[model samples]
Target chain A: MSGVRVLVGTRKGAFVLASDGKRERWDVTGPHFGGWEIFHLKASPADPNRVYASQGTSWFGQLIQRSDDGGKTWEPVGNKFVYDGVPGTHLWYDGTPHPWEFARVWHLEPSPTDPDTVYAGVEDAALFRTTDGGQTWHELPGLRTHESASSWAPGAGGMCLHTILQDPSRSERLFVAISSAGTFRTDDAGKSWRPVNRGLRSEQIPNPTAEVGHCVHRIAMHPSRPGVLFMQKHWDVMRSDDAGESWQEVSGNLPSDFGFPIDVHAHEPDTIYVVPIKSDSEHYPPEGKLRLYRSRTGGHEWEALTNGLPQRDCYVNVLRDAMAVDALDPCGVYFGTTGGQVYASADGGDRWTPIVRDLPAVLSVEVQALP
Target chain B: MIRVVLPAHLRKLAHVDGEVTLDVEGLVTQRSLLDALEARYPMLRGTIRDHVSQQRRPFVRFFACEQDVSHDAPDAPLPAAVATGDEPFLVVGAMAGG
Candidate 1:
């Protein structure tokens, strides 16, 4: 029987929500590594049973956990993430240069073909790779050591490399998104990188369209159309069709474009989803109504999908990594909110239901469809 | 047997209950006891101390005989009460965070 597993990372810990193909009646097993913050959890596409989690606490520093039995059991692996060379420095919030420091892992991207290979996007804006199934990690320093890196500054939420995307058709091509540093691409693997923020404009910075220094919240792409990318910037919704060589504004009619998470539909290459928050500073639904906007035509034309979401008195915010889509036949959409609710829709985004509630504030959500 | 009391979170990570007892082969100092502790509970390596510096974590404190031994030298000999197992060496997660 086919099933779906939703790996949720929360402010407090981690939770694994499971269900059969029916897409109802979820079994929640959770609070794993309780009292500790679970930043992200992901399963390998090559081996679904193999999983990776970024577990850490303010006092204990960072630790990586690996599960071979599909989240039923886990073992601690290597957690040491040291930057290469001297690490140098980057611009601070006050325009003063500050040394790069390791804060936490913000996202985990597992290899599409190797369960033992994974990429960790970490705070202070650096990328680390683990090929020995989380036992050890080495920094892919090209992104951080770029010529423009010294001017990179932290966003409101620390300088973080929060997104990692690999080209489905090109094994050597990869993309990474960093807060306040814009997006970068590596065509020759991790050895070299270039800033691809030419079309991205951020008024918050001195130069609206500088080479870097854009606060990009999140970026998503459809596996079938890897060249086309959709992004939820700090204040705008954008689309890039030239493999991130350039981008264009597609915010269109969203009640507000200052939101976090952005995800593409499983089957529809042109369909994408975004939860528009009131503003970057406000961080809540508009008029206390929670709505998930859907763009069937990829960005410009969008429709509000609020059939089962809160219509009033809702103030929760969805994070950049809190939304995901399962590869089931009907294509399930899942997202977690700061209010500790994980909502799921079986028939795309038509209707929704909360699978589990009263969890810690959700940080990220990733789903896997079992065959 | 040198008795050690880990904080709640460390206790959970090490998967031990109550107090953890270890056999320190040499003079019991902060360095010696920590060496045995990490040897016994490998997962606790970088929790109480740093991985490279081996310095006690800022928010982690050490107490022995009701004294704040967190400032004590790593190689300095521990109090006789802790060495003799009369009082367990305490590892506390400093009063911090929400």
Candidate 2:
């Protein structure tokens, strides 16, 4: 009997929720590194037992923690993330050039085939790769040094490379999304990169449909259809069938397309999920109702999954990295809210239940389907 | 042996139950003492100070013998009480941010 391990990173610490294959009952452990801010925790695809966590605080700076025996034990690993050369400058919020600074790691994406290889997306909007587990990280500076680098400005939440998606069919190609820098895809591993924001439009920027200035909140892809991608942008939901070459508005009939996280189901290539929030300025749910919308036709058409979710007076916001899915039989969908609730829907998106009601305000959630 | 008191979070990270003790190798200046401390507990690096700059972090402060030594030059010698191990050096995480 296999099991599932859900690794949750929160504003204060990290937690692990484990359950049998049935996905009925769960066992919770943690508050690991109790007073620290765990930005993200992800397990390696090659080996389910290997996990990498990004822990930090405004007082203590950043530290990377690695777990070898699932979440049972952990050890501090290399946290040094030095840029390759002189990290110059990117555009400030006020349109002035500001020097690039190393902040915190926003996302940890372990390699699909190698446990030792992982990618770290960080604030100041940059990408780094570590081939020695979490021991060392070296930036693939091409993304940061792009021709339009000088004009890249920080979004409201600071310029952060918060989303990383790998093409399961092609090991050499990778995709990363920044807070305000739109999306970039690297075809030759991490050496070279290109911006793929053709159809993205942001009303906030002076130019609504620029090449690289759109604030993309999150992007998700199903393994079965690597070329097809879905995005929850700052204002609209989008879909791309040409591997991000161009995107089309898929916000369709949803109440309000403004959302943080977007995800695709494990087995259903055309099925996807997004929690619709009120607006960009107001991060809470619309009408104070927390609803999870599922689109069966990939995009444009959606149905609200409100069976077990809060329908009235629920103002909690789900962050961009707080939603993930496990590869169980019915395909388990999991998401954590800013109100410190982790909800699960074992049967697609019909019904839901809380794994743990109150924890630190959840930051990121990742799931590992055990063999 | 010189006594050092770390902040609550640093203590948990360095795995020190109480005030830690360190043997300074050379002239007991602020820089030398911290070098010894980091050498003994490598995990404390980049927490109290930066990895490349080697400067005390903005929110981190240093005190010795009831004197604030955070703004003092790194190479300046510490007070005799701290050098003699009678008074412990203190590293504090400033109470800042929300």
Candidate 3:
């Protein structure tokens, strides 16, 4: 029998929500690593039993947690993340030279074929890889040493390398997105990188179409169609057909395209989803109604899916990493909100239900479809 | 035996119910005590201080016998009561962030 295990990271600790393929009832476990901020949790595709978590605190620093038997038990692996070389400086919000610092791991991308190999995207904007599971980490310096890195500035959320996309068809190609500093692509694994923000326009920056200063909230791509990328920027929904060589606005009919999370249907390559928040300043839903807008044509045309979602008096924000999808037949979409609700739609986006009503403010949600 | 009390979160991480007792081989100072503590509970490394710089974390503090010893040098000797196990050396999370 197939099942789904939703790994949820929250402001305080982590939780594991499990259910059979029916996706009806769920068993919730944890508050694991209690009082600690779990920024991201993901299971390896190479091994369903292998899972990794990024746990950290402002006072105590970062810690990596790994589990061999899913999320049932986790042990702290490695907490050290040091930059290579002298660690050059990047531009501060004030355009002054600021030294790069290790803040926290924002996302963890495990290898598709090796459970022991994992990649971590972290704040101060850098990528680190651990080939020996999570036991050690070494910085991939090329991304940070790009020619324009000196001008890269931090966004409101601090300069974080939040999004990482590995090309399923090509092992050498990888894409990463940073706040304020646009998207970057590495065709030679981690040895080299280049800015891929050719058509992304950000009014917030001095130069609206600068090569590397867009506040891209999230980016998603279906594994089968690795070249087609969809992004939810600070103000627009975008699509790239040429693997991010260029992008175009796809904010067709969304009430507001200024949202965080954006994900694609597991089985439908042309189907995508976004939770449109009011605006960057106003982090709540437009009209105080929670609605998930879906695009069947990839973008430009969208429909609102709000059957079981709150229609009024609800004002929670969905973060960039809070939404995910399971690779089941009918396809299941899940997302968590700042108001501490984890909503699951077993049948695509037609209807929704809360798997866990209250938890710590959710930071990220990832799902593992197990056999 | 030197008695040390970790912050609530660190205690849960180390899986200790209350204060932890450690045997400091040499001088009883912040540096030596922490060395012993981390040697015993490896998971506590980098929590109280930087893993490389060894500088105390900005939001973490130290106190012994009700006196704030956070500003003391790492090599400075702790109070007699703390060294004698009569008083526990406290690692506190500063009252910051809501």
RMSD of each: 1.2, 1.0, 1.1
Cα lDDT for residue A307, candidate 3: 94
Position A140, candidate 1: lDDT? 96
Q: Name the better of 2 and 3 by lDDT.
A: 3
DockQ of each: 0.68, 0.78, 0.77
Which consecutive 10 residues in model 2 chain A have the weakest lDDT in total? A75-84
Docking class of 2: medium
Model 2 residue A305 lDDT?
Answer: 90
In model 2, the Cα lDDT at residue A222 comes to: 92
- Over the true interface residues, superposed, what is the Cα RMSD of model 1? 1.1
i-RMSD of all predictions:
1.1, 0.7, 0.7
TM-score of chain B of 2: 0.95
Question: Could you tell me the fnat of model 2?
Answer: 0.54
- What TM-score did chain B of candidate 3 earn? 0.97
Candidates sorted on TM-score, descending:
2, 3, 1
In angstroms, give how far residue B2 of model 2 lies from its true place. 1.5
Which candidate model has the greater lDDT, 1 or 2?
1
Off by over 4 Å in 2: none
Off by over 4 Å in 1: none
Tell me the tens digit of each residue's lDDT in model 3 across A38-82: 999999999999999999999999999999999899988888888
lDDT of 2 by residue, A204-301 (tens): 78889899899899999998899999999999999999999999999998889899999999999999999999887888998888899999999999
